[model samples]
Target: MSSHLQAHAAELAHGFSLCELAEGLGHLDMDGADDVLIMGICDDSRHAKPGYAMLCLPRAEGRASEFAESARELGATAIISVGIPVDTQLPSLHLDSMGQAGTLLRRMFKTEQAGAHLYGITGTDGKTSVTWMLREALSRYQQQPVWSTGTLGLMRSSDDIRDIGNTTPSLLTMHAMLAEACREHVHSVVSEISSHGIAQSRIAGLDFRTAIWTSMGHDHLQDHGGYGPYLAIKAGFVCDCGSHGGNVIANADHADIRERAPASSRWYGHGLSRDDVDMGWEQELPGMLRLRSRGEEVVIEDIPLGDFHAENVACVALILMVSQDIGLQELPELLSGITAPPGRMQDVLAGYGQVFIDYAHTPEALERCLRAARKLARNRLIVAFGCGGERDREKRPQMGEIAVEFADAVWITSDNPRGELPAVIASEIEFGMQKPYRAEVHLQLDRDKAIGEAVAALAEGDILVIAGKGHEAYMEVCGRRMPWSDAEAAEKYLRRKNSGTGLVSEGEDICA
Candidate 1:
């Protein structure tokens, strides 16, 4: 499938003058010639073409004007920047902020999504799973092409999902994707909106027809500055959806979202005892999720996944019910046999106790995955997890605490130690554990050896969960990234153990 909508550069760049673009920012200095006509807007100097207006965004290296010479050489007609003076004679529009300029440019170039309904989901967890399930169910139920973009990148159908770099891409790329979806006549476009994406104004101009709140946690505190700002940014999107007369699906279990969600917003929770909620999962059975709301009940028993997916599946039902007017009773059959996204509670090895792989990088996510794995395990539960380097360090210890609190044994190992030393990162995680539980914790720098240790010790009826690097295909150590797969490693270890092979290979006992 084509990555973007086919639109002539001149056609997409038409109908915007420099003065209107400057005025859109409001109260910005309209330096240079105001009458200069702009055919297109570009943030990167490398993508600048003749008649294109470039945004000189500030960066760590230098001000936006640092790239003005190159942008001018590439036929940029004008420069839009914040506090950067271009050396060229080309007209420049100076703003108080480059983010504001980016927002304005997105608004100018955004295509009209004529027939597509837009759904924006934001949270610390379940954004990817919920969006993926939503797209799958909507496409099958409505019989129209449905598009989704999030942590799994852009997925139009089962065959079209791939990474587009960022969880929520740059505004230019987002608009271009929507334009293509519109041209293909897709029915709905579901996007996973991250806290950073919203904080950076990446989805500035698009009007979402519905928005869903998954769950919030302490992750991304460093990026948003603190938990208060982080929570507010996620809530801001829910508030925006509600005020715009669009449907808002709020998680009734989360107090922050429950209170701020609009009066007309639909809610989903695990319990039916809540009097105020519109929909909820009334019963929890073995390998089944039963939901009830408004005297209507639906039971989905065909799911091969865990209990953690109960809420995500319910969120999909609520979205379809509100946006497509589908009945609650019909949801069970529609979602029958739906599969979880890659690395999300995915069962990689099933014999002699299952080995589940998940992208549970956050404390809340890890806790949920472990608790769900605990329910499935008939005996002991062994968990292997690690913290990513250069991320929110505060959560590292917290995650360590959660792993010990829920699982019978925990294997702490390297998870993309990036620039930080693997041993140093593991030590921080160990800090979160209590003295009594520290005996159960084992630190392994080599991920393959870690999985081998955890998997080899698992007896029949015992479950193993490898967390932190779910769905990822590579490992980042120091500054180099090498091809790696947690699921593949676990399977290989299980195969070797089952064949009566030793857990540790020759010359691979660094953890010994």
Candidate 2:
């Protein structure tokens, strides 16, 4: 990161004065220098910096006030307390809700995007792919700098790209990115909205011009506490978009999604024709997808990706049609060359088989990846996957069942077993299958070794799908994120095997 990029990063890390923040909060008891600059907003004291204002919240360790004292010791200049006035040397502002205060900070800094069209995509899956398509389409057709942030991090039309490490970043980071985008004179902005982001008020006050709900499925059950709350969080994004007078697009294939999404939302799906559905896609040729909407049809030719991605393309097309006024005639050409983000159904060549790296951690996502691989596999489909630790534990078994049902041979392995024993997570996954499938399941806690064994097992015409931790470069185990990459591991293993050198490449656990 250069100094210029650092400044932009700082822009995402916003700063505001105590007085301005208090004004935004409306009913806050403020005692201290109103002019003291709050140059940073942080929830964790560890991230606190000089002139930063720490928001005291209830953490597992202690209450907000307990952290406030430590933040002051760390050079934090101010504290925004929720219902508790910490006795710190620095000034403290009391508010009823810290989440509300987070929203206010964004508003006070005026980070709301201006002078461009803002688009949002929310769903369990396909958010990154749909947002990427929209970014590429908008940039190509409009011929302006288009910016996008989400699973792929920040994508500017220029060569520079930065990953913010979260699908939906903190409110401060989102605001800062929007502010920076506005400064760069970007013409279009697309963001992937997560259910957690919506429920946590991270995207509060963002006024989108258009929004899309790709599809609904089970995910993040632990974060939302239950499935109902999880669904509500996703619907909240749609409601917010509608409230802001933005056009909402949703997948009509799922009846629940269509019913829960904003009533005025346009829909896209397969084999559907109705006034409500604005677009639909079907297989018109052997290797192409045909999109039909408004009595017009466009054939997307030679799409090299999976069948599951056609829905993502249709969703993006509908969003563009509504937001950018791109017709079917020109839209197909614009979308012809769009590519999937790294690790989302990404295809790489193995020694005698094909390998796919995908971030499909959930059951539905895993199923989709396996289905896609099956369509392309000539002989058999081999899958290497594992459930993430510290997430919704219930999904672990479901994902295990899905992998075995779709893949001929299954390798159950470790996927970022953060703070949990890898063997424990693998055992829970193995618990999901019956005798037939369970008999075929192979457990290798080492992900690299699992991938290596999977490739070695693949026949000439077989396809290998490596799920969970797609583009991520680190494997977190016991609170440590060590450098690891599935794609790099696959490439190295194949190259080594091709050279008749050895199955094990340079470096220990390169693929494991």
Candidate 3:
């Protein structure tokens, strides 16, 4: 697919540019006179001058050997980084990091394409859900080419969804993705914007036609440390957006959200508190909700169910309302007609209870998903969760606390504890639990068994939450990523349990 797209893209320098601020560095370099122009700038692409080659790195596409090969394929020029890498052999100028470099590219590349719009959702929690809901809602309007980019990757179930790397693609990659979307005749794109994406300047120059702010909860504390810095970085995206002045959807119930947003810009808030709102909803169930907005009230008889999803529903609905492009009331009827995103809060009916899948690796995300499971559970809530290796370890215990709060029995299973001892990682997570825990915490580093046990333990009324790894289908161990998926494991376990076929693997499934 990339090859086809590459063919259409104009030939440029084989070397990649460093910063948007460095765009046309070729023009200044006498040595680069013969170099193919690969414009690497620390600015917006819209502002980017014409060049032979351009680079958007530190993106979802990731810096890989293939990416390096792609760079080398260009005519000729320079090689660079967000900052300088040690023992590198290319003309390079160091900056802070790749994220910043991507941001500079976003600033330089001005996507002036007509009718092509982008929606970015950023928050510790609700990012994946919001991104999906928006894409689904917008797709109702056939005229709106609603392409979605999330944990599932860019594109949807039927579409060619490929990996870009980070949950949120880098600014340059985003611009390039938008460029591709434009070339492919898309009208709009929905992207999940994580705090890491924002902090690293990945979304730098890209202009979001509309931005959705899902509820903020404690996440990335190790990277963000305190809530203040985290909130500030996440909110900065909406506040400083672009010159076009896009809509900002926020949750008024959150003090940090309202406080973090710029006081000057017009804002819309939605929640249980409905004195005044662009849109509001009353939770009927986890997935089902009743929505009221613009003098119209509609009962969302069925959607996906989860305690945290109601806010996500309102987010997508409000954006639909503001866009005025689709019949907002018509959404409830579509699910019987449409499909669901792969992992975000997916349910599996098997084992001891109902097993669920979500891409919540952060503390806040775990809390939100668990709370949703609690709300939806007719009985006890059992969570199978784990922390990723080499990530912010601060949230591990907090995640344990969330499970301890909602689940009658919580299984500490490895999500993607890459390179780290699964037991050590689980231990840190145990710190957050309070006394006389509601749930019996068990460490099962083997994710498949963690899921199988959680499911097997359930007895009708229990709710099983498989968090951390959502749409993701692999697990990283000792620096090697292996084929692992929570959803698949849940499905396989349930499939086996329902058929009474495969015996549950004990220690084989869980970490020691």
Highest TM-score model number: 1
Error of 1 at 458 (Å): 1.7
The clash count for each model shown is 0, 4, 53
State each model's CA lDDT, in order.
0.79, 0.76, 0.64
The worst-scoring run of ten residues by lDDT in candidate 1 lies at 2-11
lDDT of 1 by residue, 11-91 (tens): 253656777776657444446556677777666777788888776644412646657767789997877775445555677
Runs of candidate 3 with Cα error greater than 4 angstroms are 1-27, 31-75, 78-110, 242-244, 264-273, 325-340, 349-353, 505-512
Quality of model 2 by C-alpha lDDT = 0.76
Query: Given candidate 2, what's the lDDT at residue 212?
Result: 85
Write model 2 residue lDDT over 9-53, tens digit each, in one string: 132245567777777564544465667887766767777778877
lDDT of 3 by residue, 271-354 (tens): 545655666777765447777766677777566666567667766766776655556567576432223466777765523437
| 1 against 2, candidate with superior lDDT | 1
What TM-score does structure 1 among the candidates reach?
0.90
